[model samples]
Target: MGGMIIVEEGALRIVGGLVDGRPVAIVQEADDVLFRVSGNSIEDAVAVARARLGAGGGVPSQRAPVDVPVDAAAPTPSVPPRDLRALLRAAVAAFDPLRSEGVTEGPGKDRYRKIYVAGWPALVHYEFLPSHARRHMGVELHVETEKAAAVTGILPALCAVVRDAMPGQAVVHDPNWVGGCGRLQVVFPDTATADTLARAMQQLIVLTRPRVEAALH
Candidate 1:
């Protein structure tokens, strides 16, 4: 017969049958020998165990019961990890608008909003300082575009929009163009500021960004 154990949400348990005259539970799922375990009640458990006994399941008997703690009390995270590597990778992957041209790179920690205009530098880094504990702060936008209009026109337009939406500071095109993997990042003073700035940018960029030409029929 199969064994029964009470478990919570994260409880790991014995999920195998007797093998080699000893109880054998797996640490994780086993490929070929998985179907052999189908026990619930005294009757069903034994039946499932026996069905796979002679088929291919070896006679090994070393089942280990795992105790996975219940996660009902643990709070789910609202924010992603601050690790720059993972953050940059995620940003690149999710840069849906840039599906075709130009690659996405780094959460390069910058003291101020760093811009890349012409060619990439050997090293480019930036930082994001969140304003969670602080009452007020500002967000600086960093960006790049194949069109010169983005540097002169688009980014300037974005600054005006942000000012209108929120009390924003000065917006200037960085004369020092430090390039890299071809993506731009705007660092906000805090999480809240970042979110708001991104939202505003998205609204404006959607309408203004050069539309992708439709495929020929």
Candidate 2:
């Protein structure tokens, strides 16, 4: 009621592509509502989604506010209470606060809104913006290469390594592909833990960056 979005579940028509910006998606069914949100933990968001989606409805008859909050300064005694997107945005701020999400251009030189943010348990291409957030932890690691296409080759391995490195406390998201570059998110459970692991990753990238640069070149 407060934060969750109530999108009438149905096979909505999605038209326009190639030249037009419309890309259709049949998210849920007609009878049930589809609750999309971003949050620190995938489980937290999913929990709320299930509850809200299960609560049948037409419209609230009242506009509700999104539940996501902001935390400019991170690493508090407790996990920052924010939705998934806000938490990712906070992580992005720690690395490059000034950088704009900017715009995206497609095959036909058509432009649209674009932001480089990490998504997990769900990809941004799937259209997810959570109403609330739990908390997140991870290292702010950025990878730069000559060709963004290079991500295609190393992403799987990188994800695996990052997962193995952080184990359960990880959610690597935000694989940016623009300006001939890409970015990665290496989330951890806490600051100290993430810092130690992030250092190791930094050392590893020193060796891996060259190969990706050379291969892409």
Candidate 3:
């Protein structure tokens, strides 16, 4: 089976402070492996990791190539098939940077990943909005704390921060969100690739983690 490989900066053991290196994670049927790799960029790190695994920097196919005669009469489709699950997996792989910052990814439903933000595990919701004229696919990052005090104190501030940063998108606070705890949510159109989703999550982390830290102290 083709393994799930992840390349991220820094080690998992070291936290709270900054780590100054890159790490490659390879999870397969044989074994789960993680090791440091020397590189300036993720691409470089991936290459090194691929070498270690005896991979040629491409996804290994399960089946071997078979010779077949081409049918020239067959009509070629205009667009290729899109695999949402594969895209989600790619998105998770792109979120390697978040892992270093203690933003662990848990299981998610259908099209999104469950991302931990500011110590609160929230779902990265993928909604199908038929009402919208354009960009029907909506991606929302909803963060909430179970602590009652934080709902009144932190969520509003966090909502405001997201609203101010992304004025074009919808940002709201739902008091009934996630059972009873208040949730701060920021929504945007899902028009980009997996890398873009990872970047958006990282950007949100950068914007709100400081306030979260201050509230904790």
Candidate 4:
């Protein structure tokens, strides 16, 4: 109300200004008041309108202060909060440019793409799966070769190496694929920092690439 306000003839029309780039509108009838505020609950919208009106004159003004106090507004987020995909992307981007390049959004919203590890035939993939409150990060190595049987045969040893290399990480050999294709996958909780995840992925590739190349040969 201190900033600006507007009033209409129908019922009790109170139009609050924009808070955080979202408009807040309040309409009061004889019994109850209805509020429409973007990104905020009805109670919050009413509180904001009342506070603004009290601060300024009872008459609504065109210019109203919509900025809520920091304490009263939504809580601030921690760095790299629960967005595993975004964190993975940042990690790949910060890795050595020569070895890895091109981090783009994947086919799905929860996936990241174009993650290239040095000496690896195919680009790596990262995806985030949410289960309840926990978030899981999936790293995949799509091993495509003419000798699909050979690649499939070495999956056990490759998985063993991956398990040893990435302690506490879950490694699986996913055989479900089209012709001449398989995947070596690793899933782990996304609790580590971006740099840590990036290093883990790079090391995983380094440990497994030789085995894959040998199988191809």
lDDT score, candidate 4, position 152: 61
Report the error of model 2 at residue 166, Å.
Answer: 2.6
Best by lDDT: 4
lDDT of 4 by residue, 1-217 (tens): 2322334333444534334334455544322345444326433454565554453345554444343322112212232336766765665565445243443333444355445434334422333222223344555666555444666677667776886676434455565534535666665444545665556666766777667667655
**Deviation in angstroms for 187 in model 2?**
2.4
Q: Per-residue lDDT for 1-217 in model 1, tens only?
A: 2222211112221233323223333321211123334433433444344444441254443433232122101111333324333333333334335322332333444322221212333132221223222211222333333333324334444444543443222122232343411222232322222334434335323332332111000
Q: Write the per-residue lDDT of candidate 2 for residues 3-72, one digit (tens) a residue.
A: 2222222342111111111111112332121324433443344334434554234433232322221211
What does candidate 1 score on TM? 0.26
Candidate 4 wrongly placed segments (more than 4 Å): 1-81, 97-110, 116-134, 144-147, 177-180
Question: Cα RMSD for candidate 2?
Answer: 15.3
**What's the CA error at residue 194 for candidate 2, in Å?**
8.4
Hey, what RMSD does candidate 1 come out at? 21.7
List the candidate numbers ranked by lDDT, top first: 4, 3, 2, 1
| Per-residue accuracy of model 3 over 1-217 as CA lDDT, tens digit each | 1111232222211001001223332222211124445434434544555566555456563433221112101111222334555655666688665554566666565545666644542432212111122221233344344453443466666766875776334444555656655555443333346675566567666777676656545
| TM-score of each model, paired residue for residue | 0.26, 0.34, 0.45, 0.47
lDDT (Cα) of model 3: 0.43
Model with the higher lDDT, candidate 2 or 3: 3
Whole-structure CA lDDT of model 4: 0.49
* Whole-structure CA lDDT of model 1: 0.30
